[model samples]
Target chain A: MTEDKKSVCKPTVFEELYKKHSKDVFNFMFYKTGSKANAEDLLQEAFVKLWKNCEKVAYEKAKSFLFTVSSNLFLNEKKHEKVVHKYIENQNKSSYKDNDTPENVLRQKEFQDKLNNAIASLSEKQREVFLMSRIDKKKYAEIAETLGISVKAVEKRMHNALVILRDKIGKI
Target chain B: MKTEDNIENKDIFLAKWIAGEISDSELKKLVSEEDFNVFQEIKNQSEHLSVPNFDTDKNFSAIKQKLETPKKKSKVIPLWMYAAAASVVIMISFFLFKTSSTVIQTSFGEQRIVMLADSSEVILNAKSKLTYQPELWKFERKLKLEGEGYFKVKKGSTFTVETENGSVTVLGTQFDVNTSDDFFKVVCYEGKVSVKQQNKEVILTQSDAYQNIQNEITTWNSKNEAPTWINGEISFEKTPLKIVFESLEKQFDISIENKTSSNKLFTGTLSNTNLELALQTLTSAMQLKYTISGKNITITE
Candidate 1:
């Protein structure tokens, strides 16, 4: 049944793969670099590369293939210059409707910034796995499958990331 | 919290807690009450934290455009570059034959204002070359422009600026003429100016703009009384990214290797003084990204 499926080279099939995987892949890159602009650049490069090599990449393997390609691209970029990891926060103020006092809002914003810095301070490996699990809500097994790592490794990274973040953020 | 359990077991337990596999009472049993609250808050806010929203459709179109843009001919010069070089060479050789002509050229990031013998003023933009014969100027006001120049011609019989693409003639008025390979633009600020390109002739009055991009003629009303470049700002109105990159290259004296085939149009203004701010302005607006290594820059989407 898998062999009878359409080739990934077909525009329709390739586009389907893009729509399905591009967002996650972009988030994956964003989590790694902590910069949306860099992530967008790397995302475009990975998809274009996938299109160029569609003959070899099957539809089922496209997501992992993109992840691997983008990861490698990010690494190569890192070798040339120190990648600045500034996570620009877009204010999602409406989500916290519990108390709308001015002081409470300022305190929340301060806490958010500190939390962002703590996350950015984590090791690249720990940060990616942790964000993939917490932010993207991916399972350990799914994250393992995409990163080509074992589930045990994913769990270890996630746990370490939490411990480090908790220590850095301290109280609240 | 058991002493007999190893680190791996704790890893699995925390992972399960994060995945919501463990009940809150059970999680509290593993950690202090304060720890439980912090852990719960971390989990909740981390989920709430959002990165920039990635537009799938827009990026897919950008990717499709990149894939379609021809990449095999990396060694060959692009058509616009070829046209620009040829036009400059032709303009230079035409001047080389004139022994009594005066030529004024501005290097990269340099602009110059020259007062003609006829008391007319000409402001040359960066990387521009202007040539005129003083002897012939008394009989007929004619000059050649290799790049971009704004002319304030003295009221006379006919003042002409010859370019590779076409010629602009004015009788004592202010106007700007810009020419490159397959691109010609004439903006009139005051008085009447007649633009001739191939077989097409257009007359532009005050606040009139005429542009021919690959034989496609478009005319629009001007907004400003003078070119903004004189004020140290480069402005574009629905201009292609290619032209924007070229202008940046000329202004910053840098070579930009554009790696994408994105035909996105941009309408904005950029400062000529600061390269970093200019690149940020252009890339962020175009929804693209760039990396600068040494003097070379690469733009991608």
Candidate 2:
């Protein structure tokens, strides 16, 4: 379906697939590396790959195929020996942590505190796939395709990841 | 809810609950139980996760500017080291070009802005594609776009953008093309654009759209409105039924068909109505019916 993805004139089918998958792949990588800068770079890199081989990608399977490529690229990038520039530490907390209220402020602050630490403690794969699927709103099927796993496996993994996170995150 | 029997049904219940397919009574029962606590915990955790949608306008613009700058002169090396240095240069250039070109791609519902050979820019909307052929760009300033793209061609002697539908030849022009679906439309924004659709040729100035309607060629003048949903709003005045559905299809990324072919002639002027309202208005006006599930929007007589 995307055979002419490399064609100069028309918009290829793979582009639509990339638009659908970029957020999922980037968020997955971001949650894994715990760095926004790295996630952005990785996302851009993953898209470049999709454009090159767009001809092989069918419209029906583009979503899954993109994820698979993203996950692979992210994993390879993570297996680096040399360290480059350090990530810019998030000195200023995101406004997301600040709730507007004098009464619930204390509780919201406490909730934020727990979330910060709990999120840091999840295993690599668990955190990466979980956040990609949950936080980025990617479907389980997309996550599974990116990780080269079955949908059932993705479901099980997501549920397990959620369970671990639920036990540790928030004020439940 | 914590009973062994209830525990056995939890997964099925959870799936149904997420989809909102559970009966009201069943939902009420579940809400009143301890399992609801677990569900609440999951929701709380979910709420804490934040998505930071960063804008890369600066990065994109800076890269584009660099691409547009005229070529700089390279320093010459000694002739004795020419063979070795040339081979080294070739290898390095090849590696850099390959890595950059192969690293990014787009899918349906995705658009990317790319810096072309001439330094003029193109914004690809969803379901559109742009590819960079760096090494071969010097010979012919050419780039490929699939799906659809809005091109702001920079002023240059020779610059052209290609698509499966046709080729737009121009030195500099601002134009938008819808190339993803079966139909291909070109709307010139600023300068003139000559659009070549295979054997059939069409040229469009600014604010004009070259569209093929039901196998008969037709051109839409400035009076005929262009699609503008990408800016998060749509304005239609006295637009036909088929065109309205086409624009809506791009916005919702779903198909809306008039299968019965009963009221092929539909006229409406819509602005800022919700998608459902728009659908309802069109369906009611034409006395047509539709069934929607997932991404599928099927229409009937």
Candidate 3:
């Protein structure tokens, strides 16, 4: 058990992989899900999946697996949230509450709300792709690989998310 | 990039537009020269969406902490998922917990589903508050509610979902209890849930009903009821203007600035639409001019 694990068991390899990719993985998830809590959950789940399948998993392919699992799980959670309207209180120092505008930030409060709704309203997968692209700032190649779809599909969802947002918020 | 490329390239046009990198030819492709002016109006609204105030480290940590409990399979859901949520490896370095003594509170439209140490799950509604003595309740799982929550209590010998106005005692059942402004409603989705309102106890059995909303219980008595938000389904039931705004806020995690809200109530059944289309329905229905300003939805007369 001891001597052969180093021969085939690659925890050392996995540790190195975690060090290299966990940040990007977590960031991608955080941006996609729009909740730190959901992001963290996805991040851990991705790694756990990788660990369980470590025998067939390669370091290079790990990134793809993590992102794929993350995207799917986040989408699943969004789809079946179970609890309705579960708010986290005392949880944030909300970056900007001041709604400065032509009206001097009067609508600032409403702005964040609209953004949240806009994102939430998006098809969970589309929202994920958009957040990962813009907020996590992921590249098309990385996203395409992780999503197990063509770059064209990723771009399409990203495009649809934007269109829906523009149309929804644009009229308001 | 072919004959019917418009269907495919339509998304590309949007992507390029969002990046502010659209070409002249593509710009023309989006809208004809005549409608270009009007299309831009909608496009202007479309570009207003963006992620905000995201601190990756802090957020990841908060998620990690909530999910840090030991892996226990007390229900149908597999425990593998929770383990994936709070692994120490993925645990971010920074997290901010609530400083307030209030154990349960929601901001704006945020909802929380909490599984107590005993494995009962509760869904807290928007702008609600729940305060319970966390300690000194080892023998019996005790908590107080001041807002709306749907509880799925794990089978415990003495289990109760209590509130300021009333309390619901349970022998392991599922129910939704909404207690606010001295009005209380308890709807049992599963099992037997009894309501106690000051020396009066009424048991709510499942038959598709709503309890104590604005001082009346609306019972459809159909087994299939609408728990829209839980499934990310937007069900707008010809509600009032203010309440509609409130629903929008809850659904989007955003708000609207109403200098003065209208008294007119709306009645319609709206089931799934993309977020924008849904909001657009409001603007069109109200005939109000709305300017989408980067996460902010500003409406003017």
Ten contiguous residues minimizing lDDT sum, candidate 2 chain B: B85-94
Backbone steric clashes in candidate 2, count: 38
For model 2, how does the per-residue alpha-carbon lDDT over B1-301 read when each residue is reduced to its tens digit? 4456356655445434432445545645755544465455454545446655655544343323333332342111222231210000000000112223312233434445555545555554544445555665667766566555556666776656666556667657667665433445566666677777757666677676665433445566543233343333444433356666766665567777657756365555433325677677778887888788777777887
lDDT, model 3, position B50: 41
List runs of model 3 lying over 4 Å from the truth.
A1-12, A31-34, A71-104, A107-109, A170-172, B1-8, B24-29, B32-301
Chain B TM, every candidate: 0.67, 0.53, 0.52
* DockQ of each model vs. true complex: 0.34, 0.10, 0.11
Error of 3 at B50 (Å): 8.0
Clashes of each: 0, 38, 29
User: Can you give the lDDT of residue A7 in candidate 2?
Assistant: 39
Residues A16-114 of candidate 1 have per-residue lDDT tens digits of 888889999999999888777788889999999998898998777888899999999999888215556655453666547776788877766777777
Q: Model 1 chain A, poorest ten-residue lDDT window?
A: A79-88
Considering TM-score, which of the candidate structures 1 and 3 is the better prediction for this target? Answer: 1
Best-performing candidate as measured by TM-score: 1
Could you tell me how far off, in angstroms, the CA of residue B225 lies in candidate 2 after the best superposition? 9.7
Those runs of model 2 whose alpha carbons end farther than 4 Å from true positions after fitting are A1-172, B1-111, B180-182, B223-227, B234-247, B255-258, B262-274, B284-287
Candidates 1 and 2, the one with greater DockQ: 1
Q: Which docking category, incorrect, acceptable, medium or high, applies to candidate 2?
A: incorrect
For model 2 the local lDDT of residue B11 reads 43
TM-score of chain A of each: 0.88, 0.65, 0.69
